[model samples]
Target: MGNTDKFEMIANIYDTPERIQIAKVSSDAIRECLVDAKSKNAIDFGCGTGLVGMNLLNDFKSILFLDTSQNMINQIKQKISSSNIQNAATLCFDFEKDSLSDLHADYIFMAQVLLHINDVELVLSRLYEVLKESGHLLIVDFDKNEKIVSDMVHNGFDQIELTEIMTKIGYRDIQSKTFYTGSKIFMGHDASLFILDSQK
Candidate 1:
């Protein structure tokens, strides 16, 4: 939610072929890490247009598509309405600015969302509070990219450092892997993505 205005402006055209492909890969990576998900409810934090979360609807009992930009939430809402998806919902909320104490979930997965958060540890801890006991938090993001630089978003993340932060925040059974690589994915520089799985 760091660059809220940019995401709000691009919400209408966010679902490009490249992004769809990346979403598919990210969804697949998340699917592999799911266990007994059919009985669980999930939160797709920073869900952009519901691309990745839409692919995963059938895997979970319900999914809350959450984002900071209202336009992004509207886009996902339209998709849910047009498809008559019963198990999906959307919420336009920023974890950085506010906290939702009653919003609990069996699992929470954020695809390419962590990099947009300015205070990563604070957000991660907030998400940890929202999780049900023993719930899972799957994060799909880029491996640290030295070539790409920007003030709007993180260049990427280093998995080991991230794991340490999460571990410090009380996450366990953490595991991560680089799952996909694509051209000009991060700030016009070729980059690989990684998926990190941890339990609360």
Candidate 2:
């Protein structure tokens, strides 16, 4: 299935307690690396149901929740309406298809989203384009795993390899560290995740 259709099917069940807790963990990791956030614009590149992004609204001047699935964006909109949130908006957009040249951001956060993409380099290039000078990109994804296997998803990522790729894409001051591990966290098997923090 395409990214949109696959996420649309799971939008209803995305906010399970387990997922919410995990998202909190991820957001906390991202927050630790953020500096001067209150005056900046940030985009949650794959914000599903606004779990982490909404929690981070207080930190940024504006937060754009971007996702491939309209259904996922719908959930974010509902939360926005009920909570009377300000400085936050949802957009159903595909990173692969849409030109992000018009949208520049000081920070971008992607949690558990990159593994689903088949072309990592292309997406990273696009992210670099949209980032303002000296902007940061924080990516939360699984560390390399040998036990899990799937054609539709990357088994995991190698920190050194990813860093090399990011550097090649023109990112600077890149750093990565594993932050969380959970039982059956990914694909019904135990997994650990790393957060990659880099400057454009």
Candidate 3:
């Protein structure tokens, strides 16, 4: 099965303790980069079961939980319904293939999502078009690691290389740092994660 199929199959059980902890840390990192965010609208791009977006509901006026898996979107919808979360919405979308021309946001953030994307630059450019002027795009993903090899996903990303791509895409104020390290995080090997902040 493809990666999207895998995510669909696991959506109902995706929020394991380890994943939740990682999401918490990722959200914390995203929070630190936020500035005057409460009044802004945001998109939790590639949000998986709303794990990261759930913790950030109060940080933005509204958060659109976007993912390619319908099941994952359904999982987040259930959470929104249960908690009466008025500020959260969900969208099942594949930016790589589809065009969402009318949709836009003040901020866009994704956690561990880029690694799954086949065309990183294309998706980033699509997101750039979707972001409002002066909007921010925050990314949380594992740093490059040679220990983990995968055909389905990128092993990880190089911050400098990623920054260069963002710069070429016209993003400014790009900054990134390794914020967290954990065992058995990327694949089965220990890995470090970085948080990157860039402006459109």
Candidate 4:
């Protein structure tokens, strides 16, 4: 299956109520990162169903939601429409291959999206290019660990390795927070939230 097909296959399962709840928790964490920021323009990379955007709506003057999957963008559109979130735009684009010059934003968020990307450094470099100097990039994804072997198959990253990569790319004040998710019904994974400031 193609990359889009792989994501589409799990879109339905991810949109379920249970998964949405988990998304909300993740979104909350994202919001916390931007709580003190002064940026008004924001972009949600790989924005799925608008969960992260919804949480960050009030923090930014405008939010551009970009994703590789049309299905995912549709889901996000539905949520935005239902909530009447006016300051938002949805774009279909792949971060790995697409140029981000057309959509510059002060802050960029990629929740649970980086783990699925094969070239994390390339993605980070692109983000750095599109962001304004001193801009912030917040990434929330599953951290590398033995406890989440199954999840690692699809989405995973080594915290130390990723941190080194980000630092090499000129990111500063990089911090990662490790957390656990899931209860009895589902298997929880070790997730990490990374916040970095782009240096000029």
The number of clashing residue pairs in each candidate reads 0, 0, 0, 0
lDDT of 2 by residue, 1-200 (tens): 13667889999888988899889999999999999999999999989898999889999999999998999999999999899998998888887775766899999999988998878988988999999999999999999899987977898899999999999999999999999999998999999989999999
TM-score of candidate 4 against the unseen true structure: 0.83
lDDT of each prediction vs. the true structure? 0.95, 0.91, 0.93, 0.71
Per-prediction TM-score to the true structure, in the order listed: 0.99, 0.97, 0.98, 0.83
Which is the better candidate, 1 or 4, if ranked by TM-score? 1
Q: Tally clashes: model 4.
A: 0
TM-score: which is higher, 2 or 3? 3
**Of 3 and 4, which scores higher on lDDT?**
3
Off by over 4 Å in 1: none
Worst 10 residues of 4 by lDDT: 191-200
Cα-based lDDT at residue 150, candidate 1: 86
Off by over 4 Å in 3: none
Off by over 4 Å in 2: none
lDDT, candidate 1, 1-200, per-residue tens: 59899999999999999999999999999999999999999999999899999999999999999999999999988899998999998888999988899999999999999989999999999999999999999999999998887888898999999999999999999999999999998889999999999999
Model 4 bad stretches (over 4 Å): 9-13, 35-39, 147-155, 184-200
Clashes of 1: 0
lDDT comparing candidate 2 with the true structure: 0.91
